[model samples]
Target: MANASNLVIFDIAANNITGPVPNNFGSLRNLKWLNLGFNPLGVNQQPNDLGFINSLVNCTSLCYLNINGNGLTGDLPSSIVNLSITMTELHMYGNHIYGKIPSEIVKLVNMTVLELAYNFLTGSIPDSIGELPNLGKLDLGSNNISGAIPTSISNITQLVALNLESNMLQGSIPTGLLNISTLEVLSLGDNNLGGVITEEIVGNSSQCVFLYLNQNFFSGPLPSNIGRLKHLVQLNVSNNKLTGDIPATLGDCVMLEELYMQGNLFEGEIPLSLKSLKSLALLDLSNNNVSGSIPGFIKGFHLIKFLNLSHNTLEGEVPKDGLFSNMSAFSVLGNSLLCGGIQALDLPRCQVKISRNKRKTFSLRIILLLVLLPLGSLFVCLAFIFYQYRKSKKMNGSVAVLHDQQFPRLSYQDLLLATNEFSPGNLIGEGKYGSVYKGLLESPTRTVAVKVLNVEVRGASKSFLAECETLRNIRHRNLIKIMTACSSTDFKGNDFKALVFEFLINGSLDNWLHPGPYQENERNLTLLQRLDISIDIAMGVDYLHHHSHTSIIHCVIKPSNILLDEEFVARVSDIGLARFSFFNTSNINQAQSSSTGVRGTVGYVPPGNF
Candidate 1:
C-alpha cells in the first residue's frame, strides 16, 4: 500500500464493500479525493471502526470527502478539524451519527459545501460556522439541532443556501440574515422559533428565490418591502401568528408562482394588486378574517389553478368565469354570506332588473290593463270557488301520506332518546333549515345523524318534505343513505320533523379543507387523496343527473354538502333543494326556466338569462 503514496484520487462509491475500512490510508500522502460512499461497510460500522478518517487527515492534498447514505453510527470524528487546508466539500448525510459538531470545524477555512442533514446530531449550531469565508451551502435540516441561530452567520458573505428546517431551534431569526444579499434559499420551517418579523428582515435579499418560514410563531405583518425579492419563486409563511393586512406590494413579485398564507390572523379585503401576479398557480388564504367580495378581475388570471378562500368573512357574488368555473379546483365554504356563481356552487341567485324602453312603457301598460280587466274578474270568481272546495276537502281529513313511504317507522321519541334528548352538546352541525345531532341507537347498534327541522322558520317544513321525497327515490354508494323520517309531536306539543341518516364520523369536506383551531393541524389531503374524493363526488352527481328513476338536479353542490365516512369516501348530501325533472331535454329546460327564485344556497346559481 506504501507504493500508492502518490495516488491523487480514490473512487470506490456505491459498491457493496463490507468489513472495517483499512487504517493505513495515510500512506497515500498525495491523495486529493476519497469517495467511499454508499457501501455496506460505511453503513454498518462499529464506533471504533472509522479509524480510517483519522488516517486520511495526514493527506495534505485531500480536498473532497463523501460518505453519505451510509447509515453509519457513532460521533463525527473530532480529527475532522485537522483535514487538509485545501478541503472544500464534505457530505456525510443520512446516517445515525450523533453528538455535537466540534467548534474546531472553523479550521476548514476553504470549505464550500457542508451537508450534515438527516442525522441524529444534536446541540446548537456552533457560532464558528460563520468563520468559513467561502462556504456557499450549509444544510443541517431534519436533525435534532436546537437553540437560536448564531448572529455571526451573517459574516458568511459568499453563502448561497442555508437550510435548518424541522429542528427544535427557538427565538426570532437574526436580523443580520437580511444583509446576506447572496442568499438564494433559506428554509426554517417546522421549528419552535417565535417573535415578530420586522420590516427590515426581508427589505433586502434581492437574490432570494425560495423562502419557507411556515409552522412557526412569527407574528405581525409581512414586510411592506417584500416585493424587493425580484427573484422569489415560492413563499410559504402559513401556520403562524401573523396579523394585519397582507401587503399589496406582494403584487410586485411578478415571478412568484405559489403563495401560502393560510392559518393566520390577516384581515381586510384581498389586495386588488394581487391580480398582477401573472405567474401565480396556487393561492391559499383560508382560515383568516378577509372580507369583501371576490374580485371579478380574478377571472382574468392567466395561470391560477388552485385557490382556497374558505373559513373567511368574504361575501357578495363569486366569479364564474376562468378558474372559478371548476368547483373541484377551488373552495369557498364557511362563508355563509357569499352568493351567486356557477350552478355547481349551489349559491342563491342575484336579482336581475327588467330593462324597458321608457318612452313606450306607459302606453304598453295602459293597453294591457284595459284588455285584462274583464278577464281578471272572471278568473278571480273561479279561483274563489276552487278555494272553497279545497278547504272543505281538507276539513274532512286525509291519511298521513309522508308516513306511508317505504322507510323505517321512527317516531319523535325514538330520535329524542337516540340523540340524548336533543341536547345542544349532541349537535354536530347547523344549517339554514335545521340542526344535525350525533346520536346512537341501541337496537341497530350503530351511530346516526339526526337532522331535526326548525319548523318555526317559514320554509323549514317544505325543506323536510323535499329531502324525504328526494332521499326515498335515489340509491348510490356516494349518496347519503336515509334511515327514516320522524313526523311526530315533541314534548312541548310542537310539530317535530326530523330525518335520520347513516352517521359519517369524519364530518364534511368543508371542515377538512379549512380546519378550525380545534381540528388537526397537520391533517392534509395529498394529491391522490384529493383525486379520489373528486371522482367519488362526480360519480354521485352523475347518478343523480342520469341514472336515477327520475332525473334530479342537486340544487346545491358545495363542500359542506359533501360528507366523509371513516374511510374518507365522499358522499353527496343535503338534498333539500333537489328537484325532479323529466329526462327529455325540453322538459329539463322548462323545469329550470319556470323556477322563479334560487333554490340552492347563495354563490352557486347557474348562469344565463333565466
Candidate 2:
C-alpha cells in the first residue's frame, strides 16, 4: 500500500474496520481525497495514534480528509499545520482527540469546512480560526472549550453555519457574529454566555434559519425586531434569565416550526399575533410567569405536536381541540386556575355565567333579613366555638406531636440552622402548601429536604399533620424516607412546623421529564430508564393501595412528587394528601367518604374524582 503513490482518492468509510491507521499515506503523493470515517481505526489507544497525519503532509494535492468517528485518541498534533496548502476540508469530529486547537491552523488559508466537534479538546478556541477566509462551516460543539467566543469570527464574510453549543464558552455573544449576511445556522446554547441580546443582533440575522440560545445566563427581553428573521425555522431561548413579555412581532416569523421559551421570566398572555405561526410543531412556554387565559387560537394549530404551559399563572377554560384534545401531546399542569380541558386532564368544569338581567330582584327588607340573620347566628356560633377551643387548648397545651414514638423530634432553631435560616438560595421547590429547601444537618452529618409549612395558607397545617401521620409507619423501598419532624415555635413565638426527609441527589422526576434551565443538558432520560422509573412508581403505588398493613391511597401522585436517587431509582414523595383505609367494611365506607371533595392537584386528579 505504501507503493501506491498514484492513488488520487482513497475511501473506506463505515466499514467498522479496526486497528491503527497505516502511516504510509504520504506515498500517495497525488491523493486529493481520503476518507476513513465511522471506522474503529485507533481503538488500541496507542500513543501518538494520529502520527499518521504527519505522513499525509507529503500528499501535496490533498484537498479533503475525513477521519471522523474513529475512536482515535491522543493530542491533535501541531504537525497538522504542515498539511498541504491546497487542503479545503478537514473532518476529525466524534473522536477522543484532546488538547488545544493549534493557532497555527490559520495557515490553512484555503480550508472551507472545519468539523472538529464532539471531541475532548479543551482550552480556548484559537482567535485566528476566523482567518480561514474560505471556511464556510465551523462546528466545535460538545467539547470542553472555554473562554469567550472570538469577535474575529465575524470577519468570515461567507461563513454559513457556526455551532459552538454544549461547551464552556463564556461572555456575551459577539454582535458581529449575528451580523453576517450569509450566516444561516447560529447555535451557542448550553454555555456560560450572558448579557442582553440586543436588537441589532436579532435584526441583522435575516438569513438565519436555526437559532439556539437556551441554557445560558442571557437576560433582558428578546429583541422585538426578531421578526426580521423571516426565514427562521426553529428558535430556542429557553432556560435563560430573560425577562419581559414575549414580543408580539415574533409572530411575523411565519416559517417558525419550533419555539421554546420555557424557564424564563417571561410574562403577559400568549400573543394573539402568534396566530400567524401556522408552521409551529412544538411550543413550550412552561415554568414562566406567563398569565391570562389559555388562548382558544392554540386549538387552531393543527400541526402542533407538543405544547407545554405548566407552572405558569395561566387561568380560564383550557381549549379542548386539536393539540389540547390529545392528552399525551400537551400539558397545562401547575396552572391551578386552568379548567375545562379534555377529560384526561381532570380539570375543573368551566362555571356557567348568568346574565344580570335574567335574575329576580329581592325586596330590600328580605335582603337585610337574609344578611343580618346570618351575621347574628355566625357571631353566636363563633363565641361558643371560641370558648370550647380555649378550653381544649388549655387542656392539651400547644405542643404538637406525631403519634408514633419511634421518630426523633427537631426544633425550629435546629431546622433554621440546617437550612441557613431558610435562605432563598437553598430553596429547591415551592408548592401550594409550603416551600422545600435543601439543608445539611451537623449532628447526623446528612443532607435533607426541609419542607416548611406555610401555616398562613388554608389547609397547610392539616397537610402537615396528614404528611406526618402518613409517613410515620409506611415503609417501602420506593417510598421517600422521612428523617424527623419539627413541630416547635420560632424565635418570634409564632408556630413553626417543618418535615425533614432524606435528600435525593438527582432531584425530582419532574426535572428529569420536563427539565428546567439548569437541568436541560443533564437530565435526558433514555427509553429503558423511563421504563424502569415507571415500574418503580407502579410498585410504590401498589404498596400504598394494596400491600400496606392498612391500605392507603396516595391522593396526589405526580412527577414533582416523585424523587430520583443518584442511580435513577424513583421514590414516591409528598404523601400529605394520603388517606388510610381500614379493612373493616364499616371503616371502608368512612374512608371512601373522607376522600371526597377536591383531594389532589387539579390537573393530576383522576377523572372519576371530578
Candidate 3:
C-alpha cells in the first residue's frame, strides 16, 4: 500500500465503477490528477469518505483533482486557495456540496474543466467565474445559482460547453456570452429570462447540438436565422409568446430531430419547407392559427412518430399518414371544418346515386326511338315531381307543428284572456331576466304554466330558433320542457313572440332550498333528496367536463340555475355561460366559432379571466 504514494492521480468516471470512494485516497502524496466522475461509485455513487476529503491538502502537489462522480457531501472549505493553486481540471460534479461557493474559487487561474454541477450549491455565482482564462467547460447546472450570468463570461473564448440550466438565474440573457465562437453546448433553459430572443442567442452554433428554450417568457417573432444551426438535433422553443410565421429558414436545419413549437402565437400556414427535415421524429405545432389543409403528401414521411396540430384554424381532410393511421387523442381538436378521419366522430358524407329510370330512358333513346316510351317517361317524371312536392309540404307541416307546439305558445291576447289582463293575482315570480306569470292554455288541450318576458318584450322579433336549438341540445329532467315557440305580428303589424314551456308543479329548486314562506312546502325536502340533487348536479358537470373529449367549466354555478322535477330529481340548468378552457380566443371574430374570454355570471369568475 506504500506504493499508493507514487500514484499521482486516479480516475474512474463515465464508467460502472461501484462502492465507496476509498478513504485511503487521502494517502496519495504526489497525486496531481484524481478523477472519479461519471462512475457509479459509493451509495448511489455518494460516499462517507467525503468528510476526510479536506485532508487531501497534505498532497501539496495535487493540481488536476477530480472528485466528481462519487457522492461527496458538506460545505466546500472556505480556505481552498492554498490547496488548489495549480489546479486545472477540478471536477466535483454529482456531489452533495452545500453553502455558497467561496468567492476565492477565482484564484484557480489554470482551471480548465471546473464542473461543480448537479450539486447542492446555492447563492449567487461569483462574477469572478469569468476570470478563468482556460475554462473550456464550466458546468454549474441543476443548482440553485441565482443572479445574472456575469457578462465577463464572454471573455472565455475557448469555452466549449457552458451549461447553467435549471437554476434561479434571472435578468435578460447576456448577449455578450453568445458572441463566443467556441461554445458548442449552451443550455440556459427554464429560467426567469423574459424578453425577445435576440439573434445572438448562441453566436457560433455550427457545433451546437441541443438548445432547449422551452417554457420561457420569450416574446416576438421566431428568428428566421434559426437555419444556421445545421447541427441542432433537438430545438424546443414551445410554450412561449413567439408570434408570426415559422421561419422558412428552419428547413436549413437538415439534421433536426425533434421540433416542438406548440403553445405559441405563430400564425400562417404550415411551411412546406418543413418537409426538408428528413430526420425529424416529433413535430408539435398545436395551439396556433396555422390554417389550410394538412398536407396530403405527409404520407411520404414514414419516420414521423408524433405529430400534434390540434387547436388551430386548420380545416379540410386530416392527413392520413404516419401517426394518423391509428386513432390518437393527441391529434385534431378545435377545427370546425375538419372531417373524415375515423368513426369516433360521426362525420356526415353526401351520397349520390343514378336513378334506374333515367338510365333506362337514356338506353332506350340510343336503341329504340319509340314515341310511346317517351310519353310514358314524361308522365313518370310528372308523377315524381308531384310526389316530391307533397313530401316537401308534409315535412314543412311537421316543422310548423314543432314550431307552434310549446303549450301551443301564447300571444298577448291568449294570456290576457287566461289571466284577465295582467292582474296581480296572476303573477308567479319576478327576477332579473324578466317576470313570470301563471297562465292556463285554453281549448282542446289545456295545461298550467308560468308566462315570462312581459307582452312588450315578447312583442319583439325573438330569436327563439337559436334558443330552441341550444335548449334541445341539453337533456335534464329538472329543466322545463320547451314545448314550442309562437311567432306572429301584433295589432300594429310588429313582431310578437313567446316560447311555451312545460311548468313543474313544484317550481325551481332555488325557491325550495331558499324557502320562501308563500310556498312553504319546500322545507319538506329530506336529506336523501338533497344528496340525490347534489349527485345529479355533480354528474351533469362531469358530463360537461370529462364525458365529452373537452372539459367545460360551468362558470355561472349557483342555486338559481338548479331546478327540481316532480320526482325530486335535482336538475342543473342554465348553461348560458359555460366556458371551454382550451378554446382559442382569436377565432371569436370568425362566425359561429367558440368563445374564449372572461365569461359567466357576476359572482363566479376565477382570478385569471380567460
Candidate 4:
C-alpha cells in the first residue's frame, strides 16, 4: 500500500548533528523553512554524502534553507536552487565547503542577504551573483577565491558592502566600484591584486565611509576625487607601490582617522593641506619617498599619539612636540634628510661653517684706501642711517596699530610658564601642530596648545613665518581659537616664539569614533552627537569657504581634528596653514577681503642667535 504525504515542520538548526543532510528531507514536501546550520556535517561526519540533499529537489515549497555555519564538505548539490525559489535570506558562513559556489544559486533572484564568509570556497566570483537586485549586503571575505571582482556587481544598486579580503584574488578592481554613491564599506585588502590605485576608483562618492586596500600591488597616482569622500572615516591603502606625491585632496575627509599609507613610494613634500585634519591620530607614512621638511603646519591637529613618518626622505629637524615628542616610535628610520631627534638613529645637526682661510684673507690695503676714499661716503651713510631710523620708527607705529586690530600680544615666558617649560608633566596630548600642554594660569586652569616651531629644520624658518601670518587673524567657532602669540628672550637673551590656543577637554574624535580595547560605553558620543558633530564641522568648513570675510580652506579634515566639547558640540581646529605652508590650497568663496594683520611671512622667529 502506498503511504500518504507526510507533514513536518523541518526546523532543527544548530543541533550539532554529525551526518550528511538526510535524503529523507524531501519526504517533508510541506516543509516551508529548514535550518541545519552549526552542525559538524563534514568529512568528520559522512565523508562525501552531501548527495543526500539532492533528494530535496522536489521540495518546491521550501522558502528558507539555512544550512550555513556548518563544516559541510564536498561539492554542493547541483539542484540546490531548484529546490527553493522563494528564499529571501541565505547565510552560509563558517563552512569548509569546497568546489565552486553553484552558479545555480544565482537563480534565487529573490535572495536579499547572501553571506558566505569564512569558507574554503574557490573559483571566480560569479557575475551572476549580482542577479539579486534587492541584495543589501554581500560578504564573501576569507576564502581561497581567485579572479577579478566582476563589474556586474555595480548593477546591484542596493549593494552596500563589498568585502573580498583575505583571498588570492588578482586583477585591477572593477571601475564600477567608484561610481556607487551608496557604497559604504569597501575592503579589498590582503590580496594579490595589482595595478594603479585609481584605476577604478569612482572619485565622487558621497557615502564611502571606510576603504581598505592594503597589502596589494597597486601603483600610480591616487585620484584627486579623494576630496569627495566627505563621509569617509578609516582609509588604509598601505603596502603598495603607489608613487608620485600624496594628493592634498585627502584633506576633504573631515571625519577620517586611522590613515595608513606606509610602505609606498610617495615622493615630494608633505602637503600643507594636511594641516586641516584637526582630528587626526595614528598617521603612518613610513617607508615612502616623501621628501622635504615636516613643517609645523600640522600643529592644529591636537590629539595624535601614534605618528610614523620614518623611512621617508623627509628632511630638517623633527619637532619635539605633539606626535613627535609623545610618539617617538612614530618616527622610525631610513630617511637620509631627517636630523636631530632623541629617537634611534639621531637626526643630523645641519649647520654650515665657512672656511677659516676665506675669513682671514681680508686685504688691509683695501680697507685703508676705502677708509680714506669713503669720507664722502661716511656723510652720505650718516644721512641714510638717520632716514633708516625714522623709517623704522614709522613702520613700528604702523605694526602696532595692525597688532591691536588683530593679533593679541603675549610674551614668550607666558607660554613657557603656562606650559611648565613644555614639560611632560603638564602635557595633555600631542597635536598636528606641536606638543599640547595643559596650561594653568593664575586662578583658572586654561588648557591651550603650544605650537613650538621646529626651528632647527632646514627650511623651518619659512614655516614659522608662514604659520604666524596665516593664523594671526582667523577666527571661527568651529576652528581652534588662537588666543595670542608669545615671543621673548631665551636663557641667553635670545628669542623663541609660540602660538597659544584653547585646550580641548576631550582628547580627539578618534577615541570616540574608534575606541581601542574598551567598551562602547567608554565613549560618551551618541548617534545624535556624532551627527551633530558632523554637521558642525561641515558648517564650519562651509563658513571658511563661503561665509568668512576672507575665505580659507582647512586642508586636513580627518576625525582627529573634530574636537568635542563637554557639551558634545564639534569645533573644527586648525585654520589656514596650507596656503602659507606647502602652497597646497583647495576651493574659494571668491570673496576679496583685506589683509588686516601683519603679512604672513614677516612673523618668522629665527631658530637660534643668528
Candidate 5:
C-alpha cells in the first residue's frame, strides 16, 4: 500500500474489512480523498489506535477524509492540526476517539464540514471553530462535551446545520446562532440549556425546516411570532418547563408535519388557528393544562397518524370522524370532561341541553301538573323513608364491605397465614403504596394475590380506601375482581389493610411486554395475541370511564397495572389512584379538580400531573 504513491482517491467504505489501519497513507502525497468508514478497521489494538492520522499529515493534497464507524479507539491525535489546509470535510464520528478538540484545528482554513459525534470527546467546543469562514455543517452530538456552547459559533455565516444534542452542554442558547438565514436544521435537545427563548430567535430563523429543543430546562413561553418560520417541517419543544398559552400564530406554519409540545406547562385551549395545518401528520399535546373541546379540524387531516391529547382539561364530545375512528391512532385519556366518541373510548354520552325558552315553557307545565296531583307528595315521603333505611344499613364501619353476602369476611390473621407469615418467597410485586404477595387460601382452596398497604406511606391509607370504593360497585370481566378485604389490627396490634384478588397465572402485561431475565420463555407474543390483550385493556378502561355505576378514572393505566389470566384475558388492576366522577357532563371540570393532586407512576402519568 505504501508503494501506491500516485493514488489520489482511496475509497473502501461499508465493507467487512478488519484489523489496524495501515499507517503508510502519508506516502500517497497526491491523495485528495480517503474514505474508510463503516468498517471494523481498528478493533482491540488500543494504546493510540488513531496514530495513523499522524501519517495522513504528509498528504498535502488531501481535501476530504471519512473514517466513521470503524471501532477505532484512542485520543484524537493533536497532529490532526497538520492535515492539508485544503481539507473541506472531516468525518470521524461513531468511534472511540476521546480527548479535547485541538484548538489549533482552526489552521484548516478552508474546512467546511466537521462531524465528531457519538464519541467520548470531552471539554467545551473550541471558540475558534467559527474562524473557518466557509464551514457549513458542524455536528458534535452524543458526547460527553460539557460547558456553554461557544458564542463565537454565530460567526459562521454560511452555517446550514448545527447539531449539539445529547451532550452535557449547559447555559442558554446563543441568540446570534438564530440569525443565520442559511441555517435550516438546529437541534440542541437533551441538554441542560435553560432561559427564555426570545422572539428574535424564532422570528429570525425564517429558513429553519427542522428545530428540536425538547428535554431541556428551557422555561418561559415560546415566542408569539413562532409562525414566522413558515418553512418548518418538524418542531419539538416537549419535556421542558415552558409555560403560558400556546401561540395562536403557530397555525400559520402551513408546512408543519410533526409538532410535539407534550410535558410542558402550556395552558388554555388548543388554538383554533391550528385548523389550517392540513398537512399535519403527528401531533402530541398531552400532559398540559390545555382545555376546551377537541377541535373538529383534526378529523380533516387525512394524512394524520398519531395524536395524543391525554391528561388535559379538554371537554365536550370527542369527534368520532376521521382519525378519531381509529382507536390506535389517538388517545384522549385523563380528560374527565370529554365524552361521546366511538364505543371503544367508553366515555359517557354527550347530553343535549335545553334552550332557555324551552326550559321556561317546560317549567310552567310541570308547576301546573304538580298543583293537580296531591298524591305525588305521599309517594315522595315513601321513597325518602326507603332511602334512609338503606343509608342506615350502609353505616356499618369505616371499611365498606363489598358483596358481603357472597365473599367471606377476612382478618389480618387470615392474610398472614395465607401468605405464610409474609415470607419473602411469597412476594410478587412492590409499588410506592405497598407490596403484593402470592398466597393460598385453605377455605376455598384458591390462590390469590394479597396487596398489603404500607400505611406508613403518607397516602397509603387514602389509596386503600380509594381502591375499595372503586371496586365496590364496578364489575366487569376485564376488571380485576376483589374477593375480600381485611382492614383490621394485626397480631402485633398495628393497623393492617389488605385486599385479596383472584391470582392470574400469566402475570402482568408489563412482564409480557418487557420480560426479565428469568422470563426468557414469555417474551414472544403473536400479533393476534397482542391485539386481543390491547382490546381487553381498552374494554376494561372503557367500563371504568363509562359503564360503571360512577364514572371512574384509573389514574395509572400502564402496562404494570394490566394482568393476563390463564386464557390470556387482560384484567385491569391497581386502582389505588382511581378518582370517582359523580358530577354531570356540564360539571366535568369540577370533578377533575376534586382529586387531591396528580397521582400515578411517573412516565406513565401525564406531564401535567408533575
Candidate 6:
C-alpha cells in the first residue's frame, strides 16, 4: 500500500481472489516480492490489456514477481521486457498470455527462473532467451510456440531443466546443449524435431534423470555413451527412426525405471546387461527389429511392472518367472518364433534339454546294463514300441481324413511357401488365436487367407477343431469358404496347424468403420453401403442358424468378424467360437444349453452368457 511505502513483502496466494489485478500496484516502490498466484484475478479483462505489468515497472526493487495460475487473458504486454533488471524470478505461466515473447525480456540479467509454460503463447522462441546469465530453469512446454529451437539456448550454462516439449518446434537438437552439466531433465518430446540424437545430448548430462525424445524423426544409432547418464530414471525414444543395436551400456543406468524404445528401427538382441537394472519397472521395445532369445534374466526383475517385446523378431523360450509370471503385464505378440512364457502368453512349449551331467550318468548306467543279460530284453521292448507308434500314426492319419472328407488337405510346407515363409510384409491381420497372412496357394493358384493356429493358446486347438467341423458341411453365399486345412509339423519339427480360406481383398469391416489417421486412402462407408453390409451379415447369420444341417450359432458376430469383398459384398468369418446344436431344431432363443461358458468377443457376447 502507498500508505506503507516501506512494505517489502506482499503475499496473497492460493486464495479464491477474483477480478482484475490492482492497476496501481507500482505505488509499492519498496516491494521486493509480490505473490498473487492461484487466483481468478484476470476475469473479463479487455483483450491485450496487460496494463498491470506496466504498473509493476515502478516497483524497481521487485526481485520476485509471481502472477501465475490466474485467469489472465490477452497478449503479454510489450512492457514485460522492461520489468525490473533486478528481477530474479518471473512466474507468469498458466495464464492466457498469447503473442511472441519480447526479446527485451533478456534485459533481466539477474533472472534465475523463467516459468512461462502451459500458456497460449505463439511465434518463435526469441534467440535472446539464451542471454540470461543466471537462468537455471526454462519451461516453455505445452504451448503453440513454433520455429526451430534456438541453438543459442546452449549459452545458458546454468540451465538445469529445459523443457521445450509439446510445441511446433522443428529441426535437429542443438549439439551445443551438451555444454550444460547441471541439466537434470531434458524433455523435447512431441515436437517435429528431426535428425540424429547426438551423443552429447545425454553423454555429458550425468545428473539428468528424465530424457524424453519420443515422437520425433530422430534417426541413427543411440549414442554409445548413452549410459553415461547414470542418474536417468526414465528414457523415452519411442516413435522415432532410431536404428542399430541398443547400446549394452544402458545397463549402467542402475537407477533407470522406465525405458521406451518402441516404434524404431533397432535390431539385434536386447542388451544382456539390461538385466542389471534393478530398479527398472517398465521396458517397451515394441515395433522394432530386435532379434535373438529374450534373456531369461528378464524374469529376475522383481520391480518390473510392464514389459513389451511385441512386434519383433525375438525367438526362443520366453522367461516365465517373476514379472514374466503376469501375462497381462508383458506382451510377446507378433514374434512367431518365441515360445513358452507364462501359460497366458499362448506361446509354444519350450523343448526340454537334458543337461550334460545327466547324460553322462545315463551313459554310465547303460554301460553296466550292457554287461548284464538285460540288453536282449531291452532291445526287444524298444522294437515293439517303435512298431506300435508307426501303426498309431497311420490310424491318426485316417481319422483326420474321415473327420473332414470335403476339406482338402495341405502340408505346412505348402502354406509356408505360399506365404513367403510367413513374412511380416505379407501379414494382413492379427487376432486372438493367431496372425493371418495373405498367401497364394498353388495348383488352383488362388489368393488365400492363412490363419495359423497357435497351439500354445489354451483354446486354440479347440477353436481349430470347431472351425474345421463347422466349415466342412456348410456352404452359404455370405459365409467364408474354407479352402483347406493344414495339420502337420513345421520345418522346425513343431506341430503346426492352419486354416486356409478365400482371401477377401477389401479387408475387414473394422477398418471401414474406424479409419486410422495414418490411412490416407481410407474412406468412410456411405449410408447405402452400410445398409447393404448389414443385410448381408443378417442373411449369413440366418443361414447359419436355420438352413445349416446343424443349427449353428455364430457366437462372435462383431464387426471385425465381418469381411468385405472387392465388390463390396459382406461375409461372416472367424467362426472359431461357433456352436453347433446337433438337434434338428430351427427355432432357438438363447445359446444352446451345451454352451457351458461365455463365448465370443467380450463386448459382443450375448447378455447372460457369462
Residue-level lDDT of model 3, residues 1-610, one tens digit each, is 3677888767666787775655565578778887776665555524343555666666667787776766766676664555656777777788777778777778878888888888888888788888888899988888888887788888888888888887888776777776676666777777766688777865555657677777777899887778888668888888878899989889878778889999999998888888777677888999887888887655555677877888899877765445567665337777777877666645544234679999998898866657677888999999999999975664333132234333354565775666556577877666433455566777745555443443354311122333344444555454445665555555777544455566555667777778777763547677657766776676677565544344455666677767666787766654434555454333423223222232445765643444
> Where does candidate 6 stray beyond 4 Å?
45-49, 351-610
Q: Roughly what TM-score does model 5 have, to 2 decimal places?
A: 0.59
Q: Write the per-residue lDDT of candidate 4 for residues 1-610, one digit (tens) a residue.
A: 0142455445668677777666677777776677787777764645565676686676777666677777776665567677667767667778766777777678888777787788878998988887778777788899999998888888888777888899889998888776776688899999999887673475566778889999999988877778788778889989998888898988877678778999888889888877767678778899888888887865445767677887887778767765556544466578787666555556677665767675565565577778877797888999999999975664333122125545556566666787788799887556433555777654345667676654454433344444455565556677667766554556776546566776677767877878778444577676757776878888777766655544554545667667777677777764433332222224233323222222222223122111
- Candidate 5 residue lDDT tens string, 1-610: 7678899999999988996888888889999999999998877757778988999999999999999998899998999999999999999999998899989999999999999999999999999998988989999999999999898998899999999999999999988888887899999999999999988667487779899999999999999989898778999999999999999999988779999999999999999999878689999999999999888888877888999999999999999988999999999999999989999999999999899999999999899888866777878999999988975564434463455667678777778899999999999999987899999999878999999989798877666766776677789999999997877787787878888999999999889888898865847778758976886887788788777888876778898999999999999998767766787633544565323243787778645444
By TM-score rank, best first, the candidates go 5, 2, 6, 1, 4, 3
List where candidate 4 sits over 4 angstroms from the true fold. 1-45, 49-69, 297-305, 327-329, 343-610
Error of 1 at 302 (Å): 3.1
Q: Candidate 1 lDDT, tens digit per residue, 297-339?
A: 7776758888999999999889988888888778999998998
- Candidate 6 lDDT score relative to the true structure: 0.84
Poorest lDDT segment (10 consecutive residues) of candidate 3: 589-598
How far does residue 601 in candidate 5 sit from its true spot (Å)? 64
The per-model lDDT (C-alpha) reads 0.84, 0.87, 0.67, 0.69, 0.87, 0.84
Q: Over all chains combined, what TM-score does candidate 1 have? A: 0.57
Local distance difference test, candidate 5 = 0.87
Model 6 residue 333 lDDT score: 94
- Of candidate 6, the 10-residue stretch with the lowest lDDT total is 394-403
lDDT measured at residue 338 in model 3 versus the true structure, 0 to 100: 82
Clashing pairs in 5: none
Model 6's C-alpha root-mean-square deviation from the true structure amounts to: 25.2
* TM-score computed on alpha carbons, candidate 3: 0.52
Please list the Cα RMSD from the true structure of every candidate, rounded to 1 decimal place. Answer: 22.7, 23.5, 23.7, 17.3, 20.5, 25.2
Two-way TM-score contest, 3 vs 5, winner: 5
Which 10 successive residues of model 4 have the least lDDT summed?
Answer: 601-610
